[model samples]
Target: MLRYGILFLSILFASSFDVSAAAISAIQSDLAVLRLCNASSPVSLQAVNSVLINRDMKSSETQTQDFKCFLLCLYVEYGWMDREGGFSLHHIKLTLESSKLPEYRIKKLIYSCTATEITDPCERAFNFTECFWSHSDKETSPEAEIPEKEVSDNQNGFYYIN
Candidate 1:
């Protein structure tokens, strides 16, 4: 029984680590996706491509600088500012509060770009119809949705043994 308890605890801890790793990976991938979208701009393309080609080059300083540059790029794209380099004037603030972002680079990104809310950048590319950012407030129904009425009609509806 004691060995079983120890094994269970180890499994639980391992699973938690996996979950945390997954969250970090998701955030990193989202950043990468945003970079790819802005690849048309010469400067943006270079910076983004550098990161893409050399994942091992991701150091604390590089991440900080890259994130800052990304925020600046967003500002430029949104017409919040005419030029780059000077990021202090932008309205949105993106702070590196989490441990995942060790070298904190806080700047206004959400509000300045007229982004009322933050979005997962990784998901933007999948939407073929329109710019995901434009319809931030719009709600999308699930594609494989089941009505609540149908669910309520069956006793064992929730179970799918097959």
Candidate 2:
């Protein structure tokens, strides 16, 4: 009985560690993506951190606008949004799918945040980001959710599995 109990405990601990490691790896991947997006403009992570420091603080519209623009710029830099002021839904879907995020959430976000008539890249980015921020909800944010699948390596490349 004692030996069995120890074996069960070890298995439980190992499983928990795997979950924790997967979560950490996901976070690291997210940060890496953000860094790649910010490579051109090079906004320091510290600046972004400062913006997130006081989520409850009442901020001016301009401050809000800045943050939104920053996020939009990252999306654009990532090639998820085109220079011609079009969003690549395919890319967004691919990314979210890989992350094990809900497809409905991505659809809803695109529906709510896209600027249908915008033609200029910068203006479109601004509009889209503004819309995104206005409709942003805690439950819908990718960072707020844990991935349902773990990313693993295979002969081909990386893949997610339950």
Candidate 3:
């Protein structure tokens, strides 16, 4: 019984590590895309951190036009977003395939989450982002997501997952 318990615990930790590693990779990719979006007139650190950490803006932040536009800029930077304010199925599936999601589910998400009624570009992108972000999380095991590591001031103004 003792040997069996030891073996089981080791196997459990190994599988957990793999899931954690995949989650780290996803966050790193997101960080890269966010860096590019923040390049043109930087979004406030608070705004960026809130969206990244919370996955949704506070009501006040959403109401702020500039914050809404910042979210739009993030979509454009990701490349699936098009001029018409809708997501590109090809890009979403092929180019930016999210980690751990099967292709079929990704396709379904695109169909379900595509921006439709929202007239404002900012609102459209923000809504789609919220929808997509929430759905993507649903598909993955919650334990797989590693939260962003807290960091103090630095000249580079970037956060690392480590």
Q: Could you tell me every candidate's TM-score relative to the true structure?
A: 0.22, 0.46, 0.55
Best-to-worst TM-score order: 3, 2, 1
Number of the predicted model whose TM-score against the real structure is largest: 3
Give the range of the ten consecutive residues with the poorest summed lDDT in model 2. 153-162
Which scores higher on lDDT, 1 or 2? 2
What tens-digit string does per-residue lDDT give for candidate 3 at 1-162?
323333454467656775676766665566566555555435566565567657765646555666667677776776656444555445666754646576555655665566356768777777777787777656644334333333333223221112
Query: In angstroms, how far off is 31's CA in candidate 3?
Result: 7.0
User: RMSD in angstroms, candidate 3?
Assistant: 16.0
Across 9-76, the per-residue lDDT of candidate 2 in tens digits comes to 44675567756777666655655666554553444444454444433223343244444455566676
Q: How accurate is candidate 1 locally (lDDT)?
A: 0.33
lDDT of 1 by residue, 15-62 (tens): 677567676666555545454434522233333344444432234433
Which regions of candidate 3 are displaced past 4 Å?
A: 1-42, 95-98, 139-162
Off by over 4 Å in 1: 1-17, 20-37, 42-84, 89-94, 100-162
Give all candidate RMSDs, comma-separated: 20.5, 14.7, 16.0
Candidate 3 weakest ten by summed lDDT: 153-162
**On TM-score, who's better, 1 or 3?**
3
Q: By descending lDDT, how would the candidates be arranged?
A: 3, 2, 1
